[model samples]
Target: MAGFFSRSVRATADEDAGSDEAPLRPIAASDAVRRVELLDSFEAAGLGWFWATDAQGRLIYLSDNASEKLGWSDGEAIGKPLGELFIPERFDDPNKTQRPLVFLLSARNSISGLNVRLAFTKEEVWWEIAGKPQFDEKGRFTGYRGSARDVTASRESDLNAERVAQFDPLTGLANRERLTTRLTETLTSYRNSKRACALLTLDLDRFKQITDTMGQQGGDELLKQVAARLEQIVDSEGEIGHLGGGKFQIVQPDVDDRGALGELGQRLIQALSQPYSIDGARAIIGASIGVAIAPYDGLDTKELVTAADLALYAAKGGGRGQYRFYSSDLKNSVQERRRVEEDLRDAIANGQISMHYQPVVCAKTYKVQSCEALMRWDHPENGDVPPAVFIPVAEDIGIIREMGEWALNEVCRQAKQWPVELRVAVNVSPMQFAHDDFAQTVRNALTNSGLDAARLELEITENVFLGDIGRAQGMFAELKELGVNLALDDFGSGYSSLSYLRTASFDTIKIDQGFVRGATEEGNNNAAILTAIVGLADALGMETVAEGVEARDELELVTQRGATLVQGFIFARPMPNEDFVDRLANGQQTYEARGPAKYRAARKTVFRRIGLIHEDNRYKVVMRNLSKTGAMIEGLLEVPLGTQVVLDLGGGQLAVATVRRSKGALQGVEFENPLISDGAEGLCTRHRVSPYQIEAAGRPLAALPQDPYSLIMGEQEGAGSPRQFVEVEVGTPKPGTGY
Candidate 1:
C-alpha cells in the first residue's frame, strides 16, 4: 500500500508540472506481495510507517503500528498533519511546515527519528525516522516514505555527551578544546584587519599548595569557583578561555597601548583576589597575569601565546599578584638565551671556560685584599664571551652546578698560589646551593685545595633562598660551619628592604653595582642610598663592598661614604691569574705614602707580607724608605713583640730598635740606639758609613733626623739577595692583623 501511494504521488507530480516522464515500471508480483508482507512485518516489529502529502501538508497514510505505539486509533491520525496528532496547538503554527525535519529528510536523504523532538500537548516525546523522497523513472519530484521509532531517552543521553565535551566538568566554562576553537575563529577574523590584539595569560600563584593539601575534589571545587568569577569578569569584555588546571588565556582585540593592557591585567588580578566560596568553604587564591600585545610582542598566534606564557613566568617570578607586559626583547633574548645555553653546556664539558680574578680593594688602604673569582669564557671561535651572557645561560641550562663547581675549584687552586693573606671570593650560582650535596661539595673543595676556609669566600644571591626556604637555610648554615665567608651578592637587586642581615647568616653584603655606578652622579640621590647601605651594614656588624666602580669620582665617593671595599674597572679589570698577581705587585711598587717622613700617619702603610719564613732567624731587609737615622722596613714576618733587635743598616753602623708590632709583612720598631751621632760628617766618620747624598748614587741617601731611629732599618738592599723576601722579627701580631 505504501509503495502504491509513493507511485501515485510521483505520477501526479509529473502531470502537475506537465513534464513528459517515463512510465513507472510495473511492480513485480512477488515484490508487490512482499511489500505488503514487509509492511506487516514492520508493524509486528513495533515500527511505524507514515506518509505526508507533498502539497496538502497532511498525513495521508498511517500504519496501525503507530496508533498502537502512540495508544491512539488509526482513524484519529489519518488526514491530519502528524504534528497536530501528537503536539498541542499552542506549540504549532498551523500554516508552517516542519522545515528542519523536512530539509533533513530531503537533504540528508534519511534522518533518525531519535533526533526529532517537539512539544506534544506540552508533553515531551522523541521519534526516530528514516525517510527519502521517491521519484518517477524520469527523476520527477515525488513523495516520501520512512520508518519512525520513539527514542526520547536515547536522544537525551546523546545530548548529555555533547554537553560534557564542550564544557569543563568542574568549572562548566568552555574547556580547552572549545576554547581553542573559539580562539582560532576569533584570530582568523582579526587576521585581515591587521589590528593588534592582546593575550593575557594567567596562572594562580601557589595553587599547587592548595591542591596538595585539600585533595583533588576540593581543589576541583575551588577551581570551579575561580572559573565562575573569571567568567563574570570577562562576560562583558570578551570571551573567557580556560586552558585547563588553573590556567586561562583572555584575548582582547584592539588594545590601545601598554597602559590599557596593563590595566586589564590588573583588573583580572583584582577579580581573582577576592575570596571564593567553593564547596561550602572559603578559599583564597593569588594570581599572576602576563600580557602580550599582538603585532608588537608577536604577530602569529603561537608566538603571541608563547610570549604571553613567558611573561606570565616573569610575573610569577617577579612575585605573585603582579603582571608584566611582554616585550620583543624578551622574546628575542629568550631565543638567544636558549642558544647560549647550548653553548654553555658544551663549554663546561670541553674546558673552554676559564676564571679571572678581580681585586676587591680596601678603599682606605688602597690594597688588594681579596680577589673575586669571575668566570670568563674565551670560546676558541667566539673569542671573549661576556660573563653577563654566559652566566645567565649557564643558570638556565641546569649545568650551572657543573660550571659553579669548576669556578670554585679553579678559584681555590690559583688562590693558593697568591700571597696567603689575600682571600678569594667565588660567586656560587644558585644551582650550587640547591644541589643535594652542596655543603659537602664546598667542604671537599676546601679540603682538596689545602686553602684556609677563612680565606675562601662564597658569594650567593638573595634569590637563592626563594625555593624551599628551609633547605636554603639549612644549606647556608652548614656552609657557614665550614668557616667559609658568606657574602650576599647583588644585595639590593631582588625584593628589597629585607633585613637579610638579621635573618640570613651572611657575613657581608656586596652592594649591587647599579647603585654605585651612579654614586657620584653630581650629587645624585644614589650617594645617599650608598651611604645608607654602608651604615646599615655597619649597624648589622657586616662588611660592605661596592661593585662596578668605573670612574675615579665614583671610587672616591664610595670611600668617603664609608664603603670599606670596592671592586670595579677603575681599580683593575678582572684579569687572568698571572696578570692579576702582576698587577698587584706593580701597584705596590709605585704607590707612595701620604704622610711626612718619619711621621705615624701614613696614607699607604704596608699592612702585611705573609710568606714561608726561612729557618734562619736572621733575614735580609729591604728599605722601601730610608733616612740617616731610621727607615721603614718591608719584611716577610714581624719581630717578636717588644724585642729589641739589631739591624745591619747595610754599609756600616748598626742600629738597634724594639719591635712594636707586626702587620702582615710590615714590622714597626722604635729605635733604641742610633749608631751615628749628630751631624752627617760626624756620623759618617764615626759609623764608617759614607753619607751618600740623595742624588749622588742610584740609591737613597741617608739623612740625619731629629728622631734618630728613623734610619734604623732604612738601608736599601741593592744586591737582590733574598730579593722577594724582606727581613724583620717573627711573631709580631700587627703584620698579620687581617689574617
Candidate 2:
C-alpha cells in the first residue's frame, strides 16, 4: 500500500542532484504518485516480479504474485535470504544451465537477464532476473531492488533443442558431437593429472544386409534395442554414444586395465551378436570392437580416435565378431589384410584354393562315417591361408557365394570318386544360404556330379536364421525336398534356439569346438553341457557330432557323453582330395586317436623374444609357449627353480612370475597373476606400466616406449649386481616341436 520505485527506473536515476547532466526539471507530486501506482500495477499484472533484499542479502519485499506462484506467502518469503530463493536442480541433468545468479549477487555485480531456478515449488520453474546494488544519496549501502520474469517455458524449449543436438533421435543415446566433446574434455583433464582413459569403437557386422532384408523402420528399431543392451552392459562405468548408424563409441575414464577393457569389449560383442526380434522379425548381427588406451595408444583426441579406428579395421579384417587392441603395427596388419582380400578375389580361378577332407568318425566303432570338406587357400607368398582369415574376407568382398557354390559342386564331384561309402559334408555361409536359388544350386551340384543327394550333407550355422524365420523355414523345406541332408554347424556357439530344431529337419547337430576344448578341464561344466546336447539330439532322432576332439581324453569324454560322431586332429589332419582317395583305396578307414593321452592346461605354442628381468639384470630370452598360468622361456642357462623374475611382454606389459620348472636353459615360469583374454584369440596381462611413472622419473609424458624400464630405472639401478647366470643363444624351434 506504500510507495514503490518509479515506472522508468533509468529516468528516476537521472533525477539525482549531483549528476553531471542538468536535471532541474522534476515530476510533480501527483505524477510521481501516478508512476508509483504504475509500478505496482506492473507487479500486479504478473508480467514481471519485483524484489528487494537487505544489505545482508536477505529478502525485505517480494512480489505477491511471484511468492504465491511458489506456494509461498509474502510473510513466508519476506525475511528469507536471497540465496534461498533459487536452488539449482541436478547439475548433471538437462534442466540446469545457470549457476552464476548467486555468485554475481554476492559480488554486488550487475546481473543482466541471468537465469536461475526457483525452489520450494512442486515442479521445476526457471526465472530470468536482473538487479543492481542499491545505495543512499551519500553512497551508503542499502537494500537492493531487481526485476524477474518467468522463463520456464523458454528454458524447457532450449533444453529440448540441446537434447536434440546432443542425442540420437532414434536411439536416444549421445550423438557424435557430444561424444567428441566428452572425449576431448576427458582427455584434456586427465592429461594434466597423468590419468588414463580408454576408447572403444564398434561397428555392427551384417547390419547392411539385415537392414536390406528387414526395411528401414525395422533397422531403426534394432538400433534402439542395441542402445538398450549397451546401457545394460556398460551401466555407469562409461559413456555410450551412437556415432551415426550402426557405429557406436564408448569412453571410459580412469580405466587403463587391458584385461578389464577386453572383457567389456567381449561382452559387448557377444550381447550385440545375439538374436533380436524386431516387429516379429528375427535378426542376428555381430559387433567388432577396437580398443585404445590413453598415453599408451595416444595422448590426444585425434590420435586416440585414429588409433582406435585402425584397431577396429583390423578386428573386422581378422574376422568380424572380434575385438582388437591398438598396436603400433596395426597399420601394417591392415595393409596385409587388404592384400589378402585382393588376392582372394581370383583364388578359385587360379587353382590356388582346393578342398581337404577331415573324417567324421563314429565315436564307438572309431570307423570313418563321413568327411567334412574344409577349404584351403594357398597364397603364393603366405603359403597356407587359414579358413578363419580368408573366409571372412571372401564374404566381405562378395565372393563367398560363388566360392560356396564351387565347394558344393567340388565336394559332390570328389565324393563320387570315393570307393568307400563316405558322405562328404560342405560348409555353408549365411550369405549363400540367404539366396533364393540356393536349393537349385545344390540340385545342380548333385546332378552335375552324378552323386546322390543323401551323400551331400550341407552344414548350416545359426546365422542362417538372421532374417525372416518363415523365409528361412521355406528354404529349409526346399532344401529337404532336394534330398540333401542338413546338419547344424557351430551349435552352442551362439544364438541357439529349440524352435529351430522344431521347424527345420536337421539330420545332425555338430557341437561347436569350444565345448569340446574345455570339457576335461577341472571344475568345467562343459561335459554336462555336452551330455545335455547329446541327449537333446538323441531325443529328436538326430545324430550329434562332437567337434575338435584332439586328445584321447577328449575322445573318451565325447564317447561317454553319447556323442555319435567325432571330428578333429586326433583322428587325422585334413588331407587333400588325392590323399582322401588314396586312404580309402589303402583300407585306412578306421582312425585311432594319436594325440596326448590326457588333457592339460591349454597353452598356445609361441615363438617370440621377450625380456626376462631378475633383480637389476634384464636378459633377452625366447618365449616358446604361453598359457594363462605359466610360460616357457629359454635362456639363462641352469636357472634355479622358484626364483622370482619379471617377463616384459611388450606394450609396457610386465608379468611377475616365479620359475616353476627348469631344464638346462629352458625354464617354465608360473605367473603371480594369470593372463586374461584380450577380447580375441590372445591373452594379455591385466595391467601395464603407466607412462606417468616414466614421466615421474624425469622424462616428458609420451606414449609407451619399446622398453619402459629404460626410462623408469634410475642410473644407480645398474650398479646393484653383476649377471648371475650364463646367457645361451636360442635357435629357432621348428613348428610343433615341444620346448
Candidate 3:
C-alpha cells in the first residue's frame, strides 16, 4: 500500500508540474513512502473518504473505513454504478435548476458540494460529494476522483428548519406561506393555459367556545384531528394548508365546474363540522367555506383570496355550517350581513322573534305525536327573515342564548294550550346548552309556562355533546330528572359515533334531513344509513324520526326503514301559532300526507329577477322557484306553452327550456338538461360559458354583470329584434286574474 501510494503521488505531482511553468522539487523515495503511509493512516482514521469512478461511471475504489460506515462489506461497492449508489435530493421549488449526478458525469462537468441520499440504507444517510472530471493526454475521458463526507446529521437539521418554515407545527399541514406561494404559482401557471382552479377558504365556527371549555392544549389536539379529516377528504384532489389558528385553505387545480367544486366544499364542511373527541372530552365545532374559482372570480392570488374570504364571510353569516361560492354580490352581502347582525341584537332584546311549529306524526298512525318549534324573525324593515339568515348572526352577536331561552319559554307556554297528548320540542343550540345552568333554564321555562315537563321535549343536536363529556352527561341527567324528554336532533348528520348512543341518554334520534331528502333515489346510500340509524335507535329503545320527507316516496322509504315518526313538508309546512291552534280547535290531530304522490326533483324557492331569452329577444322575468329539471317563472305576459327559451341564471349559467305550463304572465319551464348540485344547498347547470369564450367574443373577462343575456346578444349579428313578450311588474297584481 505504501509503494502504491508513493507512485500515485509522484504521478499526480508530474501531471500538475506539467500544467504549470514552475518546476516542482523531486521527492525522495523513502519520504514519498512515508507520505503514503501518512495518507493511509488518515484514511483509516475516518476523517474523510476518497473515491474514484471509471469512465463508465462504475465505482473503482472507495475508502475501506467509509464502506464500513455505510454498512457495506469490503469491495461491495466496486464495479457498481456510482450514480446508482445514491439518489439526488429533489427540491420542490419550481425555480430549482439542479441536475442529477448522472447528468454531470455524462456532460463531464465538475461537481461541488452536491447533496445526494444513499440508496438502500436502514437509516436515511446523505452524502455531500465533490468530484472533478478527469481527462487523458489526448483529452479523452478517463475517470473521476472525488471526496465525500456524511451529511446525514446536518441535512436532518436543515430539513427540520425547512419543514418548520413550510408546515404548521401543530397540524403538520402546509403553513400560510406555503399556501400563498402555491396559490400564486397555480394562478400564474393556469392563467396562461386558461385553465381553472378553485380555492376554499375556511375557518372553524365557534372554535373559541371549544378553546374556552377545553383549554389551549385540547384545542391544539382538535386542530390536528381536523387536519387529518381534511386530508382524508382532499386526498389527491388538491392540497390542504393550515392558515394559522383554525383557518385552512384548499387549492384544487383544474376544478372550475361549480358542481364538483360545490361537492368538495360541502364534504369538507360536513366532515369538519362533526363532533371531535379530545382526551376524554367531546368537542363540537363546525366550519364554513368560501369558495372562489380562478378565471371567474379572479385571475390573481390576491384577488382570488379576497373573493374567497368575502364568500366565506357570507357563508358564516348565512349559517355557521354552510358553504358559499364567490359572486360579485358578496361584497354587498357582507355589508348587509353586518346590518342583520345589528338588527338581530335588537330583535332578541325586544321579543321580535316568534315561533312556528311543524308536526312530527307517527309513521303508522299518522297522528300528531310531537311538534318541533322553529324560530322565525319578522323584522319591521326587512319583513320575513329566514332563520338560516338571522340565527347565525344571533349566535355571533352573543344573542343566541337569550333568543334560545325565549324560544324555549314561548314553546313551553304554547304547549300548555295544546292537547295533553301532544308534546312540543324546542331546538337547543350547543352554545345555549353549554351554560352552567342549562338544566335549570329548562326547569324554569317549564315552571313559568305551567307546562308539564313530560310535555316539553328539548331537541338537542349532536353538537351539544362537544365539550366536557362528563359535564354534558351531567346536564343530560339533570334534565332527565326534571322529567323532560330528550331527543337527539340531526343524528348521523355530522361526525356521528355509536358511542354517543351508548353513553348519552336520549329518548329519540331524529335522522337529519340531508339523509331523508334523497333517500329514495337510486344509488344513494342514504337509505342504508337511514335503516342503520333506525335499527340502532330501536335497539337502544329510542324512537326514530325522519325529518325532511317532502315526497311520498321519501315517506314510504323512511316508514319502511322502521322510522317511528315523520316530520317535514310532506306532513305540513310549519304553521303560525294561530293556524296551529285553529287546527287543534277543529280536532285536526291526524294529518294526511298531501305532498307530490311520487318523488320529484327538489325545488328551491328563489324569487329573483332573471333574463328569459326567446328568438334572440331577451325579456326581463322573475324566477319564482328553481329545480334541477325545471323552474317556475313569472313577470312575463302571455307566453304560449311550448315556446322555446333560454333562461340566464347568472354566473354564465344558461338553461335551455321550453315553456310547459303557461297561464297569463306565469309559466313553468322544463329544462332541456337537468342541473347539478352547486355544492352548497343549490342547483346549477353543469356547464357554464367560459370566460375565455366571452373574451374571444370581445367581452372582458370579469365578474359576471347583471343581464348576461344582453351582453351575449349584443355580440351576435341582428340581435336588435323587439321583444315578443311584455315584462310585468314582479309584485303588482294582474287585474282580473290571480297569479
For each candidate in turn, the TM-score is: 0.47, 0.92, 0.83
Candidate 2 weakest lDDT stretch, 10 residues: 1-10
Model 1 over residues 276-350: C-alpha lDDT tens digits? 555554445668888766554555677778878887765654445678765443445556555566677888678
Local accuracy of candidate 3 as per-residue lDDT tens digits, 224-306 = 99999999999977889998888999998898877787787878887887777788777788898998888878878899999
Q: In candidate 3, which residue ranges exceed 4 Å CA deviation?
A: 1-81, 120-122, 134-146, 273-275, 360-369, 417-422, 495-505, 519-544, 552-566, 586-593, 605-624, 632-647, 654-673, 692-739
Instruction: Find the candidate with the highest lDDT and give its number.
Output: 2
The better candidate by lDDT, 2 or 3, is 2
lDDT of 2 by residue, 547-610 (tens): 9989998999999999999999999899999998998999999988899998777799899999
Query: How far does residue 52 in candidate 1 sit from its true spot (Å)?
Result: 35
Highest TM-score: which candidate? 2
Worst 10 residues of 1 by lDDT: 677-686
The lDDT of each candidate is 0.62, 0.87, 0.83
Arrange candidates, best TM-score first. Answer: 2, 3, 1
lDDT-based ranking: 2, 3, 1
Off by over 4 Å in 2: 1-38, 55-57, 93-114, 132-144, 714-717, 733-739
TM-score for candidate 1: 0.47
TM-score of 3: 0.83
Model 3 residue pairs with clashes: 262-679, 282-467
